[model samples]
Structure formats: structure tokens, C-alpha cells
Target: MPSPEETVKLVQQSMAVYVKPREQAEHVRRVIAYHLQSTVEGSRPGGPLCLIDASANISEPYQGIRGATQEFFKASAANSKALEEFETVRKAHTQLNQPAGPVIKPNRYEILDDKLHLINQQEKSARLGTLERHIDILSEKPATNPDFLSLKPIFKDLRPLVKVPREIVDSLAMDENADRRDLASLVEKLDKVLLKSKLLLTREEQYLQTLKSQISLDPRSVTPSAKARALDTTRNELINWIESELSKASTNADDSDAGHDSDSSHGPSTSGEKPGEEDEVAKKTRQTIMTKLGTVKESYQLYVAARKSLVAALKEPVSMSARPVAEPPVRQPQESPATTEGSSGTASYLLLPYLSKLSELTAAQKAVIAYKSHFNVALAKQLKEACQIIDHLVPESQLLPQFPWPASERAKHLNPGSLDHLTAAVSDQPDLSSQIKPWVFASDSARIATMETVAESIEDGQVGIESINKTLTEIASLFGEVNGDSASISQGDPWADLALDLGLLGPKPRP
Candidate 1:
């Protein structure tokens, strides 16, 4: 039995001698670096000698070189002055060995041989053939790189190999069997393998779920070629369904309209009416009348409602205190005498037929009219009182001159000249005189009443000078002032002569 140090040295010696191929040297260097960083001495059952190879073709090699390397590393310690020269020599050697181009590639056979060597080293300590078989299966490549078909068998072998580490092996003979003595090792190895398998399965399941989800959401389905046809069919089906629903909705809407028409045509029967006895033609005529009446009522109500709303909207309260006091009412031009004469002519012409109708009235009608005379007398008295109040408020000085009265151009046909002659002609007949008298008196009474009211306001001295100035200002704003540059006329003051000329009273004398 060789010592562990001696075994490592012999292995390194065999590698350097018989396996002196270019690729072999590179692989040995990498393996050496890996073991130096990883393997602990005397930790495993076989100690450091477990990582060695002993085949019948190769002679037993010593592990003294590994021991020497370890010794060399320890010799160059900190605070040792001689170690600096050794480091310099080591660095120079590493620089000289560095290749100029990329690292050399290893042959496939060399790589396989290296893997076999690793397997042989592991097998020396324990029968780990399952692991070796797994590596062999992974290493074989088919002609076409073995598409998806080759994955099944590889996965099946890998699944079993992952469990081999948990198999109990005899400590002395290294036989595969669970023994109480190796139970702790078996459990630890089992735990590690199970944990690795669990992690792998978890990642695989996540990957599978992602693949399945991607396939389901694919717009092209599983077959990319059918994508265009599928889209067209889906669009046509949606349009057909929409058209069908629209037709059904339109049919329902028409039925609803028919029901509404029937209800409207069969207007509600009155209290005593029976449905069957009602004539269809008469019912239609009644419906038409009711519809017209309803339309008229609706229009009239709308007009009333709109007028009320407008009146309410415009009824803004005026602040009496803020407003200047009311001035005497200004009188406007009266209708000319010629206008009155023309009005009499037009009135007589229009009333001729009414006078003819009055004569046809029975004597009983005239007797009934006389019976209502007291009511007409009371109305006349009330009118006279209103006229008195209006006459007291206005004054003559504020009145406008009577001129420019309106008369129809056609009035000349009734009277070529002398309006008095035309008036007398209309007044000659008793029936015509009675009819035209009221119209003539109504027109003259309005003018005389206006004149009387203006005369009363002037007598009461209620005329507003500010009102006159405001009126003058408004006129000036529209037509500009008579003399804007005059020395007496300020920015907004009225013309001094305007009040006198317009017959407006001058400013009230100061108290």
C-alpha cells in the first residue's frame, strides 16, 4: 500500500511521461489547478490518493510532484527575503509560456480520453459507473445533431444517474449496499442528489409552462400557414352576427311602432261608449279633430309660457332712489285736421255694411240694447275720471307742435280739396254719422287729452332740468353737438339754446 502523497506523485509522473501529448499537457495543467484549489488533504476516505489513475497499460506513478508543488508554495512565505527572487523567476517562466494567439484546440479523442481518465480516477475509490455511463451517453452525437428525438433517452439515463450517489457502498470493500455503518454518508449523498433533482425539475416545469402559454397565445395557432384564412373567417363571422342582431332589433322596433300607432288610433272611449258600436270613419274624424286641437293647445300653451318667461326675465326692479325724478310728460304732435277728415271718410266707407246690418236688426234687438244702457253710462264715467288725472300731470309748454300728421295718399280721391267737405259728406247720413262719430271722437279725444296733461305738468313745476340735459347729451352723442368748440359747452353739457328752442323750461330758480 503506497502513501497518499506517493500516489499523487506517481500519477503526475505518469501523466507527464506517457500522456505527454500537447492536449494532454494542457488538460493536466487545468486539472492540477482545479485540484489544488478544490481538494482537501485527508478529508475523504481515500485521502488525496483517491484522485489518481492506475491502469494495466500505464505503470504506477508517484505523486511526489504535487507534494513538491505544495512545498514550493509554502517555502515562499511572508517576511522571507529570499522568496522575492523565487517569485520573479516564476513570473518570467509564466510570461515565456504564454501563447501569442488564441489557445490551441483539443482533439475530440483527447477530450474523450480526458473524461475516461477522470472516470478511471473516480472508479479507483468507488464504483461510480452510473455517472460514467451518463457522461458516455451525453458525449455521443448523431448525424443531424440528434433533434428532439434523442432527448428522451438522454433524460431517462440522467434521471437514474442522479440517484446513484445515494446508494450505500461498503466502507471496506466499497460494495454497493446499504449498511448501518455507512448510513450517514448515504443520507448526506441522498439529500444532495434529491435537492439537485428538485431544483432541476422546478426549472424544467417553469420552462414547460412558459412554452405551453406561448403556444396558446399564438395568433397563428400551431400552424403558421393558416393564419390569414383564420383571420378572414373570424372577421366574417363577427360581421354576420352583427347583421343578424341588427335585423332582429329592427324587427322589434317596427313592432313597437305598430303597437304605438294602434294605441293612438283607438283613442280612449268616452264614459258611455261601447267599442264595437263606434263607427270607424267617425272615430277617425274624432281622432283627427282631437289631434289638431291638441296641437293647437300645445302651441298656445307654449306661446303663453314663453311670453310669461320673457316678461319675468325682463322684470328687473328699477331703483327709484338711484333714478332721477320723473319730468313733466312731453307732448307729441296731434293728428292733423286733414288726417281726421280722411279718417272719417275711411270709417264711413268701412261702416256702411255694418250700418246696413244694424237696420236689419229687429225692434226687439234695439229694445234689449237700451236695457243695457246703464252699464255703458258707468264705463263712460270711469273713463272721464282717468282722463282728468292724465290732464293734471302734463303741461302745454312741454308739448310738441301739431304738424306732420299721417294720412293715406288715396284720401285725395275722397276729397280733391277742402277736407271739411269730405267730413260733412260722411256725417250727413244718421246711420253713417252714428258709426263714424265714435271713431272721430276717439282720435280727437286722445290728442286733446295729451295737450291737457302737458299743460297741467308745466303748471305744477315738476319739470326735470337734469332730464333735459340727459336728453340733450343723448342727442349730442348721436348727432354730435351744435357747437362742440364753443367756450360755454363743456365735455357732456347740452347746448344752451336747446332747452329754449325745444320749448323745455329752463333750470329751476335757486331757492
Candidate 2:
């Protein structure tokens, strides 16, 4: 009998020498292919091992000769056993060459599902245990504890499950044996778990509500038709209301004016009127009424314009009105000297009485009077000096030469006091005093000095100490009242004596 290695060598040598080299290579290739094929096939459950057995047969082939060959056959059998062992090892090598099962890739979802299943199983087991304990307690006697009272329902619910253990049921039937305290504690724990579950459910509901509210507030949530209708309705209502109010106001104004006219015409009856006196009074009253009517009409137009502007401002699609530039207050023409005498007398009468009776004059009134007196005196002085300068500059004889001779007696009689004479004189000499008037009488410095004097006098109470100091605070305020360009004292300057004496300034300490 040959060893497994020797048998293998014999098989190789026979194939190399007896067989053609191509045939031998082909047979070796077939043997290797068959081994590989068998390995793949053998790996499967209950697959064939014939290709592996065939390789063993080739390694230890049978020889010829009855007795000698019989002995050789027995040896060959033994060798075949060793060869089979070698074939087994060769088969293992081929198996190692075979592709393995798909590489074990991790399936995340599968892992998660497995974990969830495990958790569910654990929860079921715990719940079942709890149920079993509850049943065991109930089986004894009914527990008096409140905790056991809660467990009674759980045990009752599991009554239908026949798969429950008989021992658990028997224990539950003898439940009075269990401590009442233990049962109550279990009930409390279960209540806490239920509370946590309810809280989680509430939080989920709140999250959904928040999402819904956010969606509603979005501008896109409103329909176009709804927004358009709201705008249109508001605009129409505003226009209609404005029109109605305007009509009512116009009617009221017209009625009031008509009433005033009627009342003026029908003057109060009295026993003192002469025959034609009534007629003259009536005519004057009618003219007065007509004048008042014109003023009323102008005021009414202004009111209407203001009302229109307000209405337009209030409208939904707010509109603006063209603002009218306010006209400056008109200055009345200066009266002639003769005419001024009467008006000034009346003005003085009206003002002087009121002023003399006043216990305390306002700082403004004191300032005004001081300004007026100062201006009048300064103006009179300037006029006299101007007349004197003109007299010195031009001789009477030269004046006539420079000026035109009068064409008529009226012209010759022209005096400096008369407006006509002044006009004629100016006309005669185109370059008369008008050209040098500004230089001859400068008012800038004098006006400033007068203002300063007035302000100082008002502060120091130079005019009336008792009266001005009574309102020293009020007078001090006047310093602030004066505008930037006007005469204003420094912040801490003492009040003038004249101003304090006049009682135009506020109260001060007694001297």
C-alpha cells in the first residue's frame, strides 16, 4: 500500500508520461474544475459529493493479476482511504475559494424595527406581569385599600384571557392576604404614568393648533374679493357722508344771514324818533346790514373750503386738498393830520381811561407805551432837524431857481404843510430831498437806543417802581418774549428802575 503522497505522485507521473500532454493538461483542468464545482454544490444543504469522490479514485487506480493484484487491491483500498482523506482536504481548499454569502450590510430601518419590536415585547411583558399581580391580589379577598380598588378593574378586564396561569388566578382570589398599603402604592404609580401620557397628548395638540394659527394670519389667507369689497364700502360711505354734511352747513349759514338782515331792518320801536329821523336811521341800518352780509359770505366760503379739506383727509383712500396761501393782513391807509386829530383823540379817550384804572399794567402794555412815546419824540426831533438842514442847504432865492415858478395863484400859495405843495415841490425838482432824505435822517442807531432805554427802564422800574416790581416776574419774562432781532437784555441783567416803578416788572424785595 502506498502513502497518500506517493499515490498522488503516481497519479501525476502516469498522467504526464502515458497520456498526451494536451490530454493530461485537459484532464487536470477537468479535475480542478470538477473539484471547484463540487465545492459549490456541496456547500448547499444535501448537495452531491460525486466530483470529490472521483478525484480520489484517480489518485489510487486499480492494478491487474489475480493473486498479486488482489493483494495490491487490498493495499489500494487502504491507499484509497488515505486518498479520500486528501480529497477531503482538497475539497476544503476549493470551498475556501468559493464566494461567500453577501457581505453583512447593516439595514438601518431593519435595526430600528427590531429595537421597536424588542421595546414593545418588554412593555407587553411588564404589563402582563402587572396584570398577573393584580389578579393574584383579587383572587384572595377584596382589599379595602384605595390602590387595590383601582387594580380591581385591570383584573376584571383580564378575566376573559383564559391563557392566564391558574396560580395567578388563585392568588388574586386570595388578595385580602396582601397588604392594603402595597396595593395603594401600586395604584398611585399607575396614576402618575397616566398623567404623563395625558401631558404628552396635550403638547402634541398644542403644536397642531400653533401651526393652524400661523396659517390664518398670513395675508394670502384672505380672499381677494373680501379685501376689495371692504375698500369699496369704506370709500363710498365717506364720500356720501361728506356731501350730506356740506349741504346742511350751507343751509344753516344762509338761514342765519337772512335772520340777521330781517332783525336789522325791523329796528326796536322807541318813542323818541322824529318824522324824518326814522327814515335816515333806517337807510343807515340797511347799508350796514349789506356790508355785514358781504363779510358773512366771505367767511362762509372759507368755512366751506375748510370742511371740504377735513372730509377729504378723513376718506379711506385719503386725499389732500390744495392749500391756499394765506393773504397778509391789509394795512389801512394813514389819515391826514386833520383826520388823525379826531381819530387819535377817540383812541386816546378809549385807551387812557382803561389804562388809568388798571391796578397793574402788563409788561406788554408798558413796553408798547414806552415804544410809542419814544418813537413819537424821536420822529418829531428828526423831522425838525431835517427841515432845518434843508433850509440851510438851500436858500429861498436858490430854491425858486432850482424849482419851477408857480403857474397859478393856487400853485404859488403851496405850503410845506400841504400835501399838494409837497407833491409840486418834489415834481419841480426831480432830485429834491427824496434823494438825500435817507442820509439826512438816520433812524437805525436812534431806534436801537430807544429800544434799549425802554427795555432797561422797564427792568429797573425807572418808570414806576411799586407797580413794575409788583409784576417783576412778568416783566423778566418779556426779555424772553422779545425775538432774536428785537432788543433783548442779557439773562441776568437787573430790571430798570423805571420799569420797576411803573409796576410793569414782577415783585421784588423792599428797598
Candidate 3:
């Protein structure tokens, strides 16, 4: 049992905790007494009663007395319980069970949290003064809304893939140059250019979302399933705006006229443009967003791959003692990755090849996206060029292992069929020329599946079908060994033509 002395401390604290309410009650009494001042005379010069005499109270010091009729007047037990809890906690800290010396633990907001939750519930249930009920379309962003885009919230990482703009992924498809450092340089010059494409894109997305939100207020605006839509800034911003509008819309009636007026004013222009066209615009918006994201992602991947390779090269690799005597190093004036080795027999400066191939792959991805979105005559040529570069890189890329069969049958299985190094570090990564992203594409994937089916359906070429099936099942497979450049193969003798297709040797064949 807590003693009377501890109860006294509880009473003191209880009075202090409710000092504000006491003062407020005193003010109310003074206002009432002034109104009734002439009705009654005090027994003494100034004595306390329904008629509050301020002069009488000023004559004596404050006694920390509370009125007998207050809600807190009977809270002694509760206050005593709280005081014991504090004392126990303090004793735990001291480990000596001593009396607590003024333990000050303000409420940790659990009660405040409950009150806030109640307020949110009330807001959601509150009827709007406007045509909007809590159930109305104007009362936006309900959990059950079908239009809601299920984008995972983007939280920036602690150690993000840094030192590159996010939009380089878009440039990967568009940039003709194998070196993507130029794209980096362009991004570096942000805000210096007046009214650039970046500003236009930002403004267009804003206006587009504004238009869509207005259209959605109407019941007829049925949209396609947003399930396939990837995470994007426009969708994120649109969701945030809806939440803000809903929060502001409450039981207040005056806000109804304001919202109605704004909608009426904008209705003409909004209706002027058909709502169905907005999806196409949204598709473009997502693509724009994807480009920036893809660029950042592809750039980071390239950075990681290059960084890993460079780190490995900096280390002393063991002698290739098991292989044929390794080729001698050819020193370049400036360090180049083309050189096989250093005087120390360790690899040197391996970031260049990855950087080059990464840019080429990005270009190919961009081409694919462009062709898929809305194919044009210009994109056809772009795709061809990108495909050629990809073909050239496939053989040269140390990222890929050498073909199993060496040059002709003479050197067959004698060679290691790969560069000296085919480490797990390389195997873990996807193809250097992998696609980043684009608008929804079914043609290529569907076409590939169709081709496989057609190939399997050919019962006459059973042996060929089995061979093709085996090759298809392999992780990476190709038709045949392509020897020499296209030009060399085309112009030279049939034997000299190597397996490579020569542009000069043939007119275009029908697809």
C-alpha cells in the first residue's frame, strides 16, 4: 500500500496537471459574477460565493485548492496509481527502491494516436455539404476504389546507384553512339536549357493528370484495367492529389459551392476533349517514366558489372599455367582494355568493354520500345543498325563464353572454349544487351513462341527438329558460326565468305 505521504504527492501532481482547466473555470465564474455583482452583497467586504470577489481572493495566497464539484476532485486513486508506476520505473533505474525524485514522463502519444484515428474515421464517414457524400466519387481514394493503381511506394535506398541520371535508360534506345557518356553529360547540364523537352514532359504530365481527374468525376469515364501499368510519377502524384482533396472535403457545407463552381467552370474544356484519348496519353506518360527508370537501372547495372571487373583486374590473378602459353601484352600509349594482360600477368582496365556493350544493348532496347509503341519507317532502319551492332558484340564480348567447337575441326576440343576467366561474377548477371522496358509488347514474345511451335510441327525434319529443340533449350543459342565481317564475307570467295552474311552478296530476302 502507498502511504498517505505518497497520496499527498499524487494530490499535488493532480492539481498541477489540471491547473489550466481550473483557471478557465475561474474566468467563467468571474464573467457570471460580474453579471450578478449588483444582486448580492458579500457577508464580509469580499467573500467567495456565486458572486466572485476578486479583491477577496487577492488578499490571500493561492492554497492549491480545487473545487469539490470538479471531475478531477475524486481522481486521487487514479493519480496514486500513476505515481506508483512512475516510482516503480524510477526504482528500476536506480535499483535501490528509493523514493522517486520528481519523475517526469510526459504521455508518449498513445492516447493522442487513438484520438487521431477517431478523427480520421469521422472524416471518412462525414457527409459533404456538396453533392459528395462520404460515399460520393468526389470523396476520393477509398480503399475499395477499382481505379486505384497498385504501385509499390518508392522509397529511395540508403546507398542508391549513384552518379547517373535516371533517364539514361531512355537514351539507351535512342543514342546512336556506343559511348553513353554523352547522355550523362547532357543530363549534367540540367536547368541550363530554357524550355527543354524535360520541362515540356513535366508540364504535359501535370496537365494530363488534371484532365483525367476532371473526367473521372463523371460516371461514364470507364477506363481499362490499370493492373498492367508499372509504377510511375504521374500515377503517384494523381493518388496524392486525390488524398489531399478527400482530406479537405469534410462536413463543412460552405466548401460545396466552391467545388461545384470550379467543376462547372472547367466542365466545358474537360468535355471538349474525349476521355478515352487520355489512356493513350497515360501510356506515353508511363513510357516516359519508364525510360528514366530504365536508364538509371541499366546504368547502375553497367556500373556494378564494370566496378566488379575492374576490382578483379586490380587484384593479382594467378598465372594461366594450365593453358597454352598466354599471349604477350601489347602496351598502348593510353591504357586500353583491348590489350590481353599486363607485364605482371594480371588483367588491366576492364570497364571499357562493359561500358560499350551496355550502351549498345540500351540502344537495342530503345529501338524495340519505339518499334513496339508505334512502328515507323525511320525506326525500321534504327532497329536494323542496333541489331547489327548486337550481332557483332555477341562474339567479341568476353561476358559470353567462346563457342565449344574451335576454328574448324582441326582445333576442335583443344581450346578452353572461353576466355581464361569465366568467373561466377559474370555468370550471375543477365545478358549485357537485355531489354530495359517499353509499352506493352506481345509481338516478339508471341512470335518467338509461334516460331518454336512451327519448328516442332515439322515432322519430316525429325533429326533437325531434335537438334533445333536442343539448341533452343540451351540458355543462349544461335543458328550457326558467323565468321568474319559482313563486308569481308560478301566480297570474298565462297570459301573466304566465311559463314557471315555479306550485304554485297545478296539482295534482301522476304521475311
Candidate 4:
């Protein structure tokens, strides 16, 4: 087989022969044609080896070209195989490194072809990519009617050497039609997956809201407000109970009156006075008075029950609204541990409890921005809503004073000149009574249970995004690298050498 250098020289010579005078064109055509035909037929059944040897002797230039073309194909196949192997390795490396580092691997094969040798170690894929462009130039080569048949053999022999792979050819044939169908199918499947996950996430969120409402209504950790509500409910139920009893009493009274009337009609005066009989109107009035008295008693019972519930809740620590003790009893205290500790240390202890909450809020803010920028608009919106809920529940404004006390007033309160001075300084500061308790979410066990449900749903959404992101990355990588187009060719044919060198004529491969 001819080396790559010889291939280049042979191609130059062939082109040179093509552009020569008319007489020379025919001679060159016959030489190249006969040489290619003999080479191709050498493997045929009953083909004579002697004739093949003789054909070589008839034309040295044609013989050189045939050898070069054949060698070119052999080298190309070897290079192509090497590239494929390296590509697999590269992909493995890419997977290992993932989201970072180098992508392409180093040269795995040494190319000896002159035209391709310019390909450097760092640019192996790039240099090898030129083969398609060169093939394109070859396909565009021209052929006139006079020498078309003579040149046909040479063209036919070289065509298969650089032919596009069967798969690529098939792809090109169906790209416009089949590609759309395949993409549509893939998109539909992915969309279904996305929609299903999205719905699941939405359901989880709704369930989380339900959990919050349940937590809000939980009887365990009852606050003062909740106790009041319970009292009111009890009062209402008692009133209903009283009304029911009165209705029963009224019904009994009506039955008794009808009985007395029937008795009077049956026996007018068995005795001077009756034992169980009375005037119907008087009896009805008496029944009405009793019913009214029963109603009043029921109302009194309801009021007593409600008042007792409130008083009992106030006495128990089980209630969340139980007032805190400002100072514990100091029996035989020679500076209690809390009083002895450094004020700064105590302050830091107080601050530490809130740090985690601050961190969570900060992280959620970043998540909101990241999801929005990453094209997950719905998730971003959801996160934003969550943030709003958090802010509303634990308003930052309520945690600190709108305006702080002046230094003079602070000093006066810290070291009072007199009781009147101390009182004045305290009065100058913001009203402590006006500040309501800060809302706490996930602070109590019941609230935390509800918030955990929300957290679980958020995690599910995150998992879904990660899964979809992986698929999207794979789709993106499919189009990451592509072969470049070949340089433009001249408009018309002129010199035979130039035409043949460009691969414009003879059987050249299409891109």
C-alpha cells in the first residue's frame, strides 16, 4: 500500500493529467481507467494475475494512483476505528468527572497521512474531522461527456474509500421527516413524566396546607386564645342542650292538659276538688313558666362550665399561653448559676437558638432565585409563597423596636437618680404592653409535625428537578460536537489536476 505522502503526490499527478491538452486527456483517462479496472477485477473469479501485472506496466502513473487510493481507504478505516474507541473512553472520563474538568481525551492513534498529519496531538478530533470536507470537495469534481466513461472507473474505485457511514447516510436521508417524529415522541414521554411529578408535588403541597390547619386546631398545646374558643363552644352546646330539654317539657305539658280535659268531660265532679286535674289555661301558663325556668338554668350551667374551663387552663402549664415567671424564688441564693454567668454568654446563648432559623430562611431565599434562573418558574413561585408565609408568621419587624430609646433615657433607667426619674425613663421607651407575642411556626411539637410535611414535599420537588435535569443534560450533550462544513469550491471546472485534486470528478464520496 502507498503511504499518505505518496497518496498526495498521486492525487496531484492525476489532476495534472486531467487538465492537459485534449490528446493528453484521453491518454491519461485510458491509463487511469485501465489501472483501476484491473485492480478491481484482480479478485474476480477466473481473473488472470498475469494481465493485472501487465496492466501495471502499461501505465506507471495510473498504477501509483490506484495503490494510493486503496491505501487511503485502509488508513482511513484504521483511523476511524481508533477515533471510535477513543470516543468511548472520552465519554467514560466525562461521566467520571461530571459537572467539571476536561472532556476530550488525548490522541490515541498516530495518523501518517500527509494531508491529515497537520492534525496536532491537542487537536486530534478537529484534524480528523476534515476528512468529510475533503470528501465533499471530491464529490463536487466535474466530468465532461468525452472523458466521462474513461474516468468512470477511477471515480468508482475511489468512491467507496471515503463513503459516509451507512448509519449517517440513513440519518441524512430521513433527517427532515423522521427526526421530528422521534423528537416529538421523546418530548411527549418526558412531558408526561414531568406532568405526573408536577401533580404529585402539587398534591403534597396542598396536603401540607391541610396539615398546617390541623396543627393550628390541635388541642394539645392550647393557648389562651384557644381556651377562650373552647369556652365559647361549650357555652353554645349547653344552650342547645337546654333548648332540647325545654322542648321535651313543653310536649309533656301538652299531653297532661289534654288528659285533664278528657277527664273533666267524662266525670264532672266526682269529688269537691280533683287530685290531678286543673284549669287548662292555668296549667298551660304554669308549664310555660317551668320551661322558661329550665332555660335559665341551662344558660347558667353553660356560663359556669365556660368560666371553669378558662380558670383551669390558666392554672395549668400544659397551656401554651401560661404566663412565664420573671424571677424564680431565690431561697438561700448566694448568686444563682444563671445570675453568676457572664451577661455576654447569656446573650450569645439566646442568639444561638435563632441562628438556625436565619440560616434556613437565607437558604430558601437562594433557592427561590436559583429555581427562577434555572427555568423552574413554578417551583420558584412556590418557594416564594413559602417565604411569604414564613415572613408573615414571624414578622421581622415585630422582633425589634421601630425606634430605640435615646442614650440619655437608657442611662437613666439603668442607673436611676430617683424613682420618679426611673419611671420617666421607662415611660420614654416603647410600650412593652403594645408588643404582641411573635408568631411561631414549627416552634411547638404539633406545628413542627405540620411543617415537616411541607419539608417532605419540598424534598420531593427537588428530587424531581434533579431527575429531569439529568435527562435534559443528556439531550443537550447529543448536539455538543458536530463536523464543520468544507471550504467552498470554485464555480466552474478548468484544470484537470485541480479538479481531480479537489475531488470534483471521478467517483468521489459525498459528505
Between candidates 2 and 4, the one scoring higher on TM-score is 4
Ranked by TM-score, the better of candidates 1 and 2 is 2
Residue-pair clashes per prediction, in order, are: 17, 48, 4, 10
Residue pairs in clash, model 4: 15-497, 16-497, 19-496, 138-503, 140-504, 141-504, 141-505, 142-504, 155-506, 155-507
Return the clash pairs for model 3, or none. Answer: 169-295, 172-362, 172-363, 173-366
What lDDT tens digits, residue by residue, belong to model 3 across residues 1-511? 4676996686578557544576897896675455445334432326554433222323232356444322222343344545565667566545644555876666869879989999988876663533455456545656565545444333433455566666776766665756766776686344223223444455568879999988745544533222212222233334334434634543232355456556656666778765446545655665675577556545544543454344444353468667454343333322332222231122113334665899999899667645543443344346557667767755665433422222453233223463312421333322222321110123344556679888877764898778886776552324334434422334434544233345244443223
Candidate 3 clash figure, as a count: 4
Relative to the unseen true structure, what is the C-alpha lDDT of residue 284 in candidate 1, on a scale of 0 to 100?
Answer: 69
Evaluated at residue 89, the lDDT of candidate 3 is 58
lDDT per residue for candidate 2 within 411-483, as digits (tens), equals 4444566665676463332333443443333344456668999899887775577766657746655644444
* Model 2 misplacement above 4 A: 1-217, 223-226, 268-511
TM accuracy, model 4: 0.15
Candidate 4 lDDT trough over 10 residues, lowest sum = 433-442
Rank ordering of all candidates by TM-score, starting from the highest: 4, 2, 1, 3
lDDT of 2 at 437: 40
Overall local distance difference test of candidate 2: 0.56
